[model samples]
Target chain A: MAPKVEHEMHYRRLGRNVGLGLSLFAFVAIVFWLTLAKVQRGEPVEAFDHTARPSLETQDSGN
Target chain B: MSDASLQSNVTTPAGDAGFRDFVALLKPRVMSLVVFTALVGILVAPNPVHPFVAFTSILFIALGGGASGALNMWWDADIDRIMKRTQKRPIPAGKIAEGEALGFGIALSGISVVMLALAANIVAGLLLAFTIFFYVVIYTMWLKRWTPQNIVIGGAAGAFPPMIGWAVATGGVSIESILMFALTFMWTPPHFWALALFMNDDYTKAEVPMLTVTHGRKSTRKHILVYTLLLAPVALATSFTSIGGPIYFAVSLVLNLLFIRGAIKIWRRDEDEAQADKYLAERKFFKLSLYYLFLHFTALLLQSALGVTWGGF
Candidate 1:
């Protein structure tokens, strides 16, 4: 007898997955555009700190 | 036993495992927890991730959860079928077969890890892979049948998601993520023991040595109270970190106090009185434990929001 093979995710599952993918893509696109625009206009984005951490030498270490 | 017998022992069940059964094998409830904690990890991290990468990372993390579930289902289908609590699951129900579940789990496990590496970073991908292996091989295959500490150690598998989330965003681990992991790890014993206290027979019938089964119910109750006490401090402490503030601290204090109170109330009642009356207190405690973790995580997010906007702390 030939060996049996199985596929867990089917076509319907795939189609549903694709729809979800598109929706997620759209949501991400909107957020990215807004963030980029805000950064361009010199607004500090609450989501990220653009500040660079201070170098080791800049901090007073008790020698 | 002969070598052939040993080989047959493994392969017989492997042959019967199926597709939908495999999908069912992934513990969906556990997977949802992984997704939620991971999402919180990403959200609360000091570093922000790009949206595309962030979404992809979360998606793969969810899939990693699904993969772990599938693998667990694959290995435990036999016990699953025997236990009343798990018997109705797809594999146990025979709606799908074992080999199918094994294949599905393995395939998804690879896909999730690799895709996560591509979408996010190597650390997150490696962590996801480790999470799957730990759940399947260490917890399911080995620890569950052999020891009462199965859930205690196995609980680590569930605790990895938030850490994985932290890695995906920051490409590394941190004290904050470790605290998140610790909270879940400590929370597992009481949450599960409460269910086990109520469902002791399920573990007994399946020959799984749950703490209640091995140590006796009184001991289990004691352990629950002790763990609840330990958990209360950690839960409140996490609220003081950068991601937390007054809101989270207040909520954590109130929630942990109530949680400890609930555990103590259950502990005070004799097991028979607790169970003979259909385990009402234990049941209520179990439900409350679910809300406890959610309330804490939500409060952390709320604290972050409050800090950012109010008084700009």
Candidate 2:
């Protein structure tokens, strides 16, 4: 069996590139989302209107 | 128990541990704060989010918060083993191996970030990722043991949820969300320092250099009062935002007054009085701080839900 006495846990041992990549990915993804999504028109979803629908009585007002 | 026996007891492979042990590693209590604040953030946004999107986003955010907690536990296993308050945590209690916690934390972090990105836009995902990184790397690994100002600065990690929630709905940050973040960031110091007063011995034992251990109780008291004073304006200021209304204003005013009153009581007490009273005031203040956050956030929620208008900007 492999050695069990020690466990690998040092985060600093990872390459600088990996850290840079991770940081860049996080920031770039956020910026990209903001620009791309904010600039474009989003699909409109209808919200339930509490007070604005026309009453049936209004349709026969001419009578 | 013997050293060898103790080592063998806790060093069992990951499969030997129970499910609750795994859950314990996630720090569910802290995750609840994250979930609640994030929900507030999403709800307070200028745009309303679909219930499904809100649910999915919050679930991923909680997972990310949990991931940060697991990683924190893994990194802090040594200190956790020593501290009375944390000695029973899965790693320190010998139920889960450090390696397993480490692996689990990393996996959850990755999944939460990626899934949040897909579920909502990438800003929410990125914010979640950043929050995890800050808690795990910046606050846990670096600031925690290094400085007496640990809670002061590390509070940012906890403060980001509302911003992330806002990002999920609007896909960006704003002055309003920043104020929401500031409210939590400012509140963390006095809240934690109150606990530090009562639990100073535990931190001293752990050698974690909490504000109380590094600074004397008198200075810690002064610091608590000062932060509370600073916190009042920010807490009240949120009432002028879009999310704030008449209900929020009334609640914020009362909570801030109570918070200031508690801090003043803490500031005025000496060690003799504290020992005689068994730190009762400090404990009461700490408890009030918890309600303080919940009530203030809940007030904001009430304003949004009930459309309480007179005080709204």
Candidate 3:
């Protein structure tokens, strides 16, 4: 029987680097997706009611 | 040859820069200060940024900080190899190659600057780039190796983080940001000199002309006290700014007093007395010096929490 030939792989082409790249992409994608969803749903990731002054700001006498 | 030997030949020892080693290269404790002060800078700024972008900007700033650290390690590996405190660091310990450290630092520097520009603004990105250049090229490569004034000048690199943070928020510099920069800038000399006072031998052996080695411990002590005195007013005055409040002022006053006292103690100890117990006074002063910076920044946070509102930047 003829010996089998296994193709050589670059480190960048290997699972580790590819996994890392994909994971980073996934993380960014998820964040963007969630943010978009939040916007569409009218729920902000950070919602500050401008009319309702922050308690900290209101407590101060800034005049 | 066995597969193990083949793998070992292919994977050089230099390839052993582990995850922990890379993280250590970032100087995480210092990075924490960078992140916090930068966050304060962002939060206190007059112009609000999107939270996601703000978060990414801070991360890039931190990565830039880590890059600076890596470059410092790369440049100082020779001396680091000798110092007991830093002997086991990745570059010095043979875990990571020196060239690899340089490459990593350069890569991170580019990524951080570009990413920061994308995440925040050109002003912040420029500040980050300047910080990296100042820390690596100016401080680590040149000043640290050349003069006793190294700490005095090099301190500017570390001090700029708060200003950068402030700029990220306001898109420009302000008096308050300058004051924050001054506090750290002035504080750096004394804090580092105290450590250099106690660790004089390390620098001496490494042939690094730290103040303690070049000017003698007495002069170093006197300088420490003088800088501490100068730093006190600046620290105290920062509390009166829009960002500072009752809590910050109180904490700054107390911390400065304690820090000055420690410097005074170190200054007064005669050479014989200081050496009587292997520089115990100097050692204690050095420990207190670490908390000095932390306390001031913590006070700022406390003031913010205390319902004293100050617009950022």
DockQ of each: 0.06, 0.03, 0.06
List, residue by residue over B63-132, the lDDT tens digit for candidate 2: 8999999999999999998989999999998778899899989999998899788767888899999999
Q: TM-score of each candidate?
A: 0.78, 0.81, 0.81
Worst 10 residues of 3 chain B by lDDT: B3-12
Name model 2 segments beyond 4 Å from true. A1-63, B1-11, B311-313
Residues B1-313, candidate 1: write the lDDT tens digits: 3433343323323334333344456676777787788988888888887766677788788888898787788788889978998888877775556777777788888988987886677999999999889988999999999999988899898889989998987889888888899999899999999999989999999889999899999999999999999999888778667776778878889989899999999889996798588999999999999999888888877766556432445
Q: List runs of model 3 lying over 4 Å from the truth.
A: A1-63, B1-12, B309-313
- In the range B1-313, model 3's lDDT, one tens digit per residue, is 4343344423325544445566677788889988887887777666766676677778889989989999999999999988888997888776578888888889889988887775566898999999999999999999998999999999999888878888877778888888888999999999899888778889999999899889998899899999999999998888788778777887888888889999899889878997788888778877787777877877776675565654432
Could you give the interface RMSD of candidate 3 in angstroms?
Answer: 8.0
**lDDT to native, each model:** 0.79, 0.86, 0.79
Error of 3 at B296 (Å): 1.2
Q: What is the per-residue lDDT of model 3 for residues A1-63, given as tens digits with 9 covering 90 to 100? A: 111111122321254355547747965874575455446534232343544334334345673
Model 3, C-alpha of B7: deviation from truth (Å): 12
Candidate 2, residue B50: how far the Cα is off, in Å: 1.5
Q: Could you tell me the interface RMSD of model 1?
A: 11.9
Count of backbone clashes, every candidate in sequence: 13, 0, 2
Model 1 Cα displacement at B263 (Å)?
Answer: 1.0
**Which candidate wins on lDDT?**
2
